[model samples]
Target chain A: MSLDKATVAHVAKLARIRVEESDLEPMAAELNNIMTWIEQLNEVDTDGVQPMTSVVESVLRQRSDDITDGGYADKVTQNAPASEASYFVVPKVVE
Target chain B: MNDFASRIIQGATGDWEMVIGLEVHAQVISNAKLFSGAATAFGAEPNSQVSLVDAAMPGMLPVINEKCVEQAVRTGLGLKARINTFSVFDRKNYFYPDLPQGYQISQYLQPVVGEGIITIDLPDGESREIGITRLHLEQDAGKSLHDQDPNSTYIDLNRSGVALMEIVSEPDMRSPEEAGAYLRKLRTILRYLGTCDGNMEEGSMRADVNVSVRRPGEEFGTRCEIKNVNSIRFVQQAIVYEAQRQVDILEEGGSIDQETRLFDANTGVTRSMRSKEEAHDYRYFPDPDLLPLTFTQEWVDSLMDTLPELPDAKKQRFIDDLGLPAYDAGVLVAEKETADFYEQVAEGRDAKIAANWVMGEFFSALNASSGDITQPPVSAGNLGGLIDLITDGTISGRIAKQVFEAMVESGKDAGTIVEEKGLKQVSDTGAIEAQVDEILAANGDKVEEYRGGKDKLFGFFVGQVMKATQGKANPKVVNEILRKKLDG
Candidate 1:
């Protein structure tokens, strides 16, 4: 799909990213180049060629459909940036 | 056949056909992160496992892990996909705080593996083949902490630079079920190969759902990509919402636009996140810093030699060799650990009976304890011992349940538990006959009813006999002696 500069700017806003005015031109040019490359795929005849899904051709591997831990509170909280007792601490949202 | 394609086309007024493909990112199960030697254990202290490399310290260069590559190849072979003799990694330019590296090391044009197929089993015992577009090796981005603070964001680098196999599927699925089945089948294969842990909850495996809608007979519709749908339930919900969104657009005489979208589980809707970029968006030139990866055929062959019996083959063995039902076989071979445990318990025993016990009482015990078969309190050997006791008439099934519980609690052999508890089945005919005589003598009217050809009273007699034995009577022997005494 072709991406325009206006669309890119809007996307950047949605992503909460700040793109400089100077960088916009370069970004647009790069995005256009990518679209052109992907356009090359249109030249190929994929009519009968099945799309590949996996890298291997093996049977499925499964584990018994059993439930396990949503437990391990300490391990879950071990890496929290801020913690109070066993729970993770975050900034209060409400007044 | 009115398959998913036909139904989708029909729903679109026979105008166009919807095409779909998937890109699944499965985290590699390794002792440490791909680049750093920091422990990759799940549920760890958030940033405790982070190293300087993961934190993207200045002047730190990413070093490739050989084990990750081998696992990627093993996965590629499992998929019947081509292992690119040479592949290169490129930096995917993206700005997210979670990505400490600024740019993610991912494959753009040259991925480690290419072109594979996954055959998914449909509900009606039919199978459909989905094509694998590519499987590339990439590093994971860290996480952004948005809920922690309103004005500030935090970064957890524990996940950064962790290895991932970005498996892209062809837009071959037409319905939500097929998409789900495809993901499940792929996950099953990866788990069996021991390449990926396939833990969606741990963020070990995730799906980026690509959905588009078109008229029944028309070309592919504009596709929208949904990012980071971590569970199968969410994957299905995401696709349904995305497809409806596309259909709504077409119905309003507007064209569907190709873009990246986010699924809000709370609202059950997809909102546009970004315009889907073509390949050039990331400027996907091969990385100048890293060399191309190459592997020898001998190494690939050696890995293949060590591959355990996968789900399909194992399922077939259970059916042909063990005479188990197809459903039972399918369930047993879904996971390697479960299959191995079953084999140990089923050896030298009736396969059907073994299956019943494993799937029934054993599964319930595990469930009750909130454990997996891997951590079962009762070992396969102990379970087998319990099954043997039942088959040899040492204990009736009713008595065996009691013994099995004791075994699970104490980790004792079945024989020792039975002996200690005095829980042996009463199979002696003389003893059983004496008990039956006492019961019949006490209940004269019921005994007269049995002699008078009221056959219904026979069950009452049997119940009396079992009660006399304290529920320890061998059911078969009790029935046999009760019939003889009544008939005489």
Candidate 2:
């Protein structure tokens, strides 16, 4: 699928990314390049080659399905940048 | 050559067949995040569980957690998917504030597990086989705080680098209901496998719904992906709206566009987000720093050995072994924990009785108390005691409920509570007969009227007998005695 410059900008805005105006040309070019690379796969003889999905070929390993404590609160909280009363706090916004 | 495909083809028109697919991302239940050893707990303070690796700090390189790989393989086996003897991780380049990493570590050209099939049960006893595409392991991105700030945005990396198994389903579902059922059956299987917790509300598991509309027998229409729908209700809603949207476009002489869309829960519509990109858009190549993941066949065999009775087998067991109705069995075994609890309670007792109490009184009490089967106030053994009392006719159904309430309040066994509180039914024929005689003598006018074809007065006599027994008399026994006395 081809994405025009205007469409790319709109997508960037929706994704909440700040894309420089000068970079839009390069971004569009790179996107076109990527599409060309995907098109190359069409040349391969995949008539019988199954599309690869997962890495392993086996049955799923399972537990007893009993609910247990996930176990690790303190260690999880240790990486917080800002914390108070076991909560990670952000800057106050509302007056 | 089967009649199924022919029927579907004939029902529609032309050579167009509906192709359906699914991509399910299940959050791995682990103590720590996938790449980092930081805790992977839910409902924690925002951004508290993030580690340096999760924060995408400059000197950090991801070391793949071995358990996450095992889990991915385990899930592959569950789906009966082909596990790649060797799989490589790739960097999927994407820029978002929530993704501290410039790119997400995901499986692109080579995933951990490959082609498999998942058989989804339709509404009736009929089942349909949906092709499995792949199951890959990836790291989750952080959360964006949109509601918290009007002008500025904040990132919570608590979920970042958390282990996720992306189980993709083939485009095999034809209808929205089938899609929903596929999701539900997938969730049940994952829950049964213990590979993922399947909690959509907590964002532990989510679906990226791929939908398209085509004529009955035509080639596939341009597909659109509705991303990150967390709940099953939203999944259904998103598909319905997206499918209709595609149909509308096609009907208007405009071809369907292949793109990614966002499902707005508030608006109940899917808005186009961006044109979908192929794999090369991310410049995916094997991660140079990490080695290709390989596992021994022995390990895979052992993991397979540990597999529990999955949902399908368990449902059949409930029907054949426990003699439960298919609907009841399906409900109980939908989640592994509830099914296990039911088994514990029904071990030596009557299965039907146990199912009734568990589905009725037990579930209601748990809901009323806002507790789950995990932390039920009444234990299985105690509930079995209550069932036994009712079964032995030691307590009538009405009195059994009373005793059950006491069991919940006092945390006492049914026998002990019944003994101490004198809640047992007066089933003794002699005792009930004496009470019947007293009621007949006291209500002589009513008794005369009852025998004089005033049959409705029989209820009054039964009520007096029950009152004499302090509401603990066996109701059936009382009715029989009162009827015999009135007829005489």
Candidate 3:
């Protein structure tokens, strides 16, 4: 449940967050406290209970397999930080 | 087990056994995306097929597509797998430009379909059963276009959230041929079920090939996955090259680094894409937006009942019941449309004759042109009629072949062609006798020589009679009358 400074730094890097070196110790301490408290909730002996990940208790309703919604590229790309030729543009990723 | 392990590449260290499995991603045949109402048709404009939920807009929820789930179940039944009554969907968290959602909705721990078996028809007329580990339902990612611009990468979300059935197989293959046969057989079954079109070139169907090498009876070596091999040929090449690479490494006292690799089709070699440490650690959890899928056994049974005869059963029937060669039966049942056409032609007729004509002249004619069985120029009824012309006394076998060529050219029925061309077999004894008299009168020397015990000259007289009748004379009657005329 506890996180060291290096582990906190790794978590920040994986989440794409820029955690400054000066703030790493405090961030690690805060994360450790939260993780400890969450671990307490796992100690309860609720062996027979089903795991519920969502508040909704019903199966998903299916929409009919039709092509009714489309051709709204302008509206879809309107909120993008940058767009070119009716497409969202992001930094190039090479693999 | 008469296994066709023909292509086992021998290494200096030992005879390395090739272990191969496939994870085939078949795009479901539903009209809409798996979780969104977006159109799932291929070849649409780049983003014109995207929905709000498909584009991963915040606060948007996903509604499962019922048709997709049904397709997955049907495919599972075709694979002879267990259709679990209750299964859950999960989120596989990853980041890529093509993926609009940072996490893809996939099944991890609980797939919709469990272990299935696919029967593979090997090269040596033997068959093997490959184990299917599981078949799960998932959403596809969008396509990223790198070549569209030199300075930037373009994203198309058309394929995002599209329904896909990820079928995973156990590592049961020992050679490249087995793996190739496995894909072909699986594709045939999927095409038969109408769940996937099984077109690898169109990206609708693709495979991730897993390859490992080992000594006989030894624990399995490390396996590296070659991702997105689009064709069966490439899959075989990848397995061969990857197995050899691992064997060389081990033979040289080098350990294999577990990794993900990519097959270079042009070079016929596999190169490491990424090592194991760099692999994406997909954090999988039950999808919060959807509920666990549940259905009764009745639903699965109903699907099974409606299922068409798969390739193996249909092929077996063609062999045992129809008495066809293993090769012809296989070629006929490779595609559903071809099998249906064969059935229509063979119905109530001599199936062996039907099989011969269908596989011989009919297949070659179709192959000569680039036409599919769906739109064959010669209909099944016409083909059956052609066979009937030979079966009955309407036309000789040679004359039927001539009529068949004419049918292909004109797209006319066999009977119509026979009547129009006046090519009916002259089975009338009087007509053949008259022709025989004329040929004897002209070939007086040959007739005399034939009576003088030159038995070969009798064949010359029959040839002349056929020439005079334009090859329409009944062969049996010609033989009988010519013998009587010559012997008398």
lDDT of 2: 0.78
Q: Which stretches of candidate 2 lie over 4 Å from their true place?
A: A1-95, B1-20, B43-52, B55-59, B119-128, B275-280, B438-470, B479-488
Give residue B298's error in model 2 in angstroms. Answer: 1.4
Using DockQ, rank the candidates from best to worst. 3, 2, 1
What ranking emerges by lDDT with the best candidate at the front?
A: 3, 1, 2
Q: Summarize candidate 1's per-residue lDDT along B219-284 as a digit string, tens digits.
A: 777888888999888887787767867877787789877788888889878887753443226545
Backbone N/Cα/C clashes per model? 34, 32, 0
- Go through the candidates in order and give each one's DockQ: 0.05, 0.08, 0.59
Q: Which candidate has the top score in TM-score?
A: 3
How much is the lDDT of residue B168 in candidate 3?
98
All candidates: TM-score:
0.78, 0.77, 0.92
lDDT of each: 0.78, 0.78, 0.87
**Regarding lDDT, does 1 or 3 come out ahead?**
3
Candidate 2 RMSD to the real structure: 8.1
* Best-first order by TM-score: 3, 1, 2
